[model samples]
Target: MPKCYWLGWSGQFEYLERAKQRLALVVPLTLALIFLLLYLNFRRLTETLIVMLSLPFAMVGGIWLMWFMGFNLSVAVAVGFIALAGVAAETGVIMLIYLDHALEEARTAARESGRSLTRADLHSAIMVGAVERVRPKMMTVVAITAGLMPILWADGTGSEVMQRIAVPMIGGMVSSTLLTLIVIPAVYGSVKGWRMGRGPLREGAPERMAA
Candidate 1:
């Protein structure tokens, strides 16, 4: 009969257990903070929801890239995702700000002219806002990806941990940038268009829409 009962420090699985517990606590807090920030920034539940949706959209590439790299989820990866969320939210905010400014400009013009905001007005505003902001979006994405490049390609020492942290941010930035540049505007335009169309229709609305 033999019995093994020797313990030094914690145990073989202690590190993993600690990591899991840390992740469990941190993930929800991070998400809650993100949600609160989004709600505060947008001040409209629908707009906040739209921005929140972009977080998952941004994560798509991160998941795929991680899988392709054969990396499993870890604390570093979770941290990366948290960072990605903040950046994604920032990009979303920028896009929203541009769109809001454009819409406000159009709204003011329409109000001054004694006309209601129309789908056409919204469409034009969305186009101007989204397309005109491409330079800023590109710069942001480029700067982020460029900054992560060193971490992603680092070697030796703590490279493994650094890579895990950098991978999600790099991939996320790519997707989030696209979402900010394209999808968000499309979604905003669609929502605003539908809402505007539902309201009082202006004269020549159909003709203007067709043309």
Candidate 2:
């Protein structure tokens, strides 16, 4: 017999039902909050949307990993999901910070040279920002994943308890790191392109600014 039977299966089901009901409220409200925050800081809807999309791709990997590990989807895992939301948000914020810094650097350079920052300059800045940001983020994720691996792989000493939390966290962190490093940059680039292609009438403004 399985040592740990699924606890509160009925209650779990009920909790899920309640969660489902609340999701309609939760999602829009959460999005509104994020939008409001982003608007207050950056005032750009397109950038916010791009950053948000990167989160789902990261979550896809996290979910697939948990399923492959034969872990039951439970309240603990739901907690992991909540943790992932914060992780994703943090990753987006870091990426945006790097991007903004890069843009600022490029603008300063352009001003010094008495030339407007071109599309190429902007692209270069974004690339540099992504590269610079990725190293530290990767190191952080690696350290976290490495620290948790033992717990996830432990054979005794109540390893099962640790696995429940550690597995999803490690998985989510890994996936979130990858998505933030790759997908977020791609999304940012695409948004930048779309903004640039809008022509000279709207040139020299950030895409997020346009939104």
lDDT of each: 0.81, 0.72
lDDT of 1: 0.81
Over 4 Å off in model 1, which ranges? Answer: 1-12, 198-211
On residues 67-177, what C-alpha lDDT tens digit does candidate 2 reach at each position? 999988655566566566666766787788687777778878888999876788878988998999978898878887888788866888767767776767788887888
Which residue segments of model 2 deviate by more than 4 Å?
Answer: 1-35, 154-162, 199-211
TM-score, one value per model? 0.86, 0.75
Q: Which candidate wins on TM-score?
A: 1
Report the error of model 2 at residue 146, Å: 3.0
Residue lDDT tens for model 1, 12-120: 3678679889889988888888888777666568778888888899998888888888998888898899899888987887788788877878877898999788778
lDDT of model 2 at position 106: 83
State residue 31's C-alpha deviation in candidate 2, in Å. Answer: 5.3
